[model samples]
Target: MKTFACALAALAIVASAPAAFAEDRSSARKAQDNGTRQIPVCRKNLGTVAIIEPDNQWWREFNLGSPEAILRVFVQQSRCFTLVNRGRSLQNSAMERALAEQGELQGGSNIGKGQIKAADYFLQPDIVSTNNNSGGGGIGGVLGGVGGLFGHGVGAIAGGLNIKKGEANVTLSIVNSRTTVEEALTEGYARKSDVSFGAGGGGFFGGTFGGVGGGGYQNTQIGQIIVLAYLDAYTKLVSQLGGLPENASAAAPPAK
Candidate 1:
């Protein structure tokens, strides 16, 4: 009887272990989700907003195109304001009537004239990134040298030991298009470090080979830092604007 009772107790513990672990994982995921999800302060929807392509020096330097499209993703996700296409052109009454006629044939409602909502605010994003080296030289050099003995490819892969740190700053502004006044401004900053390995080596036959390595560093990319800065800026922008009352009924000038 004693032996049977001990066996049952052990089985019960084993069965309960997985459940406890699953519960822990679930709790952790819930905590992470709560941390990441942004809750808008203003419950009511604000009026439409137009986003302008920023004159991005940082992106230009990196040969990346404008971040205006990326900014749109953040704005739309925030749900604080409706987004309108900046490229939308004004339509005349004749065009509206023609569209309405077409709609009637399709069994759809008539297209009303001047139904397009004008943007109440304009949002502009400015971003800048800089590199700041905090000391140099580490085990990365030794590992790089070892990889160079094998081949260029090996050295390049091992070069990931090399570290570089970068910082980025993003600024977002809200402007009242009608008043031409800046209503709110917010800034976000982020820092990240990247592991890079040196490329280029002599052929396996002759010549000299070189490789570079670095000390231990955080495994973060410069692009990730820039993106984080943008996300932070977006969060701040949303929080700032969400504090205002809904402006769905208000009219403002068109964005330029």
Candidate 2:
């Protein structure tokens, strides 16, 4: 009976091996092809919205593009708001209208004012802070200690593959366009301990999220961390607004 029980256990391990291998393969494919595959989606639109970038150019210091671009995609994917063009495309539109007024545009070109749609809400995305290397005790120290037992070469390679932790704080706010009153606010944070440098450095998404939130957010570890943080904030924002009663907005606390 003991022998039969051992046989059953061995068979269970063998049966699970292929399932584990298949899961690993699927995870690798998802990492390479679609890092944002799990982006939240909505069934209906809540309102027409425009993303407003802060006056400060902080994203530039991080090698990132306008935060509006990132928020634009999130809004579109979530289907929570109808996005409007308030960026450079609006300028181009104004230029086209100028040409129409000058008769430079072909006949029947109906470029004019009052055709633009009104925004019902404004979405503001902000990055509170980011730490690319956060945590106590360095990989170098661990490698040095291991080197005392292993050898100098092993320690050198380990040091070259040093991993660091990264974290970011982000926020998303929704405001009523007519009243200019803040309707809701959500904060998000993300931390990663798998960020590595030197020869062992490589991001998971590669080019998956590129051409949308700029190259940095899609390609670099710190940028990815920030994106994750923003995603968290956006998700929370949606959850906060999704199940609220219609009169919820009317119940805002009186200003102190």
Candidate 3:
């Protein structure tokens, strides 16, 4: 009996090995695909770029996760174009043009699902709201339905359930040659936030569905300000030395 138990344990270990390695490989691939944070390369000459790589993980989850990811795309696109002669440089204008012509970027990997550039900008924006804005057990509202599902009580501390069942806009703000918020998204803000909810219902009270089974609507602003600052920092770095190419985008002004 003991020997058989030992063999069973060994078999369990073997069976679980692939699942563990699969996660590791996924993380490694994700990191590899995301690449590093370096200056952007926008050459003077209009031609092919060699690398033109795209971060599959980030692009899949959320394009332009941080400003750095966007910068990577710009540089890679330049590199790939340098190799393939797809374009001469990287510019907001170029990006906009690509969307106009092909409904997506001309050279970079697929970023956006809808009309959004996905990596560099938002196809839509996010908004905030709540249905339990009443008094009394309104505090219980936030903690009631949805909380029972995701099993997260964090929102409960913030005073009732502040929900955002409304829509969100994705404001695709880009840094100009000056590294300021240039090219205000012409298509207006894209949808930035869209979360689903359904949990925490009668189930917790011996009901089958569990908890407040109808936790609807939530929103995250995505804070346009954060994006603006992120772009500014990236542009500043690219302004100096510039490992890739020339000042196709102009140098960022000195900090005060």
Candidate 4:
């Protein structure tokens, strides 16, 4: 009995090894390192940027929160621009000012108007579209052909083996806040394939996006695809502004 128990424990550890290893190679880990994309660093600060999402609420379809969450991560990590709060956090700041105006706070609170930093540029993220299952070779049709030779039961079992591909098209744009001129517009795309339900796929969300807080981006398949797409777009945007080749990285020269 003792020997059997020890054997079971050893087997359990061995069985779990691959999963642990795979987790380490997961996309969440990659995202923390900014995935495969190299972030370009600017020697001179571009300007204060405010990240905003589209008004369409298209992300609601995928159960995602806001693109601002991840976009801000890229912006801050790139060290290109100062980020200003213009989203939900802005409302919080407004509430505080309202409180100060009501004299509901202590003296010298120093909460007042004109203290807000002006955004020199507006960085916006938009999801052009997403294809949850694309480029599939008609699983049903192949299975039907198989059924003619291998019988219905075998074909049905084989039907369970499906190859699914997901893709997303995302864009990032930067505009001069004062002049309201579009400075740069870049598009990014990412595609991923899943072997099937039993195979355990997707490099993203091995367990979670981990420390950086992925929000819904860590929880769903389409969300992960979108994250990669956006990362691609941001990469291009930075490279364009830095005058580097697309998807290339280098130290940006000081602003003239």
Model 3 TM-score (2 dp): 0.19
Candidate 3 per-residue lDDT, tens place, 1-256, comes to 0000111111111112334555666543433222211223333432222222222212111212323333333444323122322224435546666675675555565444363221221111211112322234432442343344324433543334333322221122232323333333321121222211121111111221122122111111222222222233333322332232243233335546
C-alpha-based local distance difference test score of model 1: 0.48
Better of 2 and 4 by lDDT: 2
Top model number, TM-score: 2
- Write the number of the candidate with greater TM-score, choosing between 2 and 3: 2
Cα lDDT tens digits for candidate 2, 48-72: 7889886555566556777676777
lDDT of 3 at 232: 33
Cα deviation of 145, candidate 3, in Å? 32
Q: What's model 3's lDDT at 55?
A: 22
Model 2 clashing residue pairs (backbone)? none
- For model 2, state the Cα shift of residue 124 in Å: 0.9
What TM-score would candidate 2 get against the native?
0.67
Candidate 1 TM-score, true structure as reference: 0.52
Error of 4 at 58 (Å): 1.5
Give the winner by lDDT.
2
What overall lDDT, based on C-alpha atoms, would model 2 receive against the true structure?
0.59
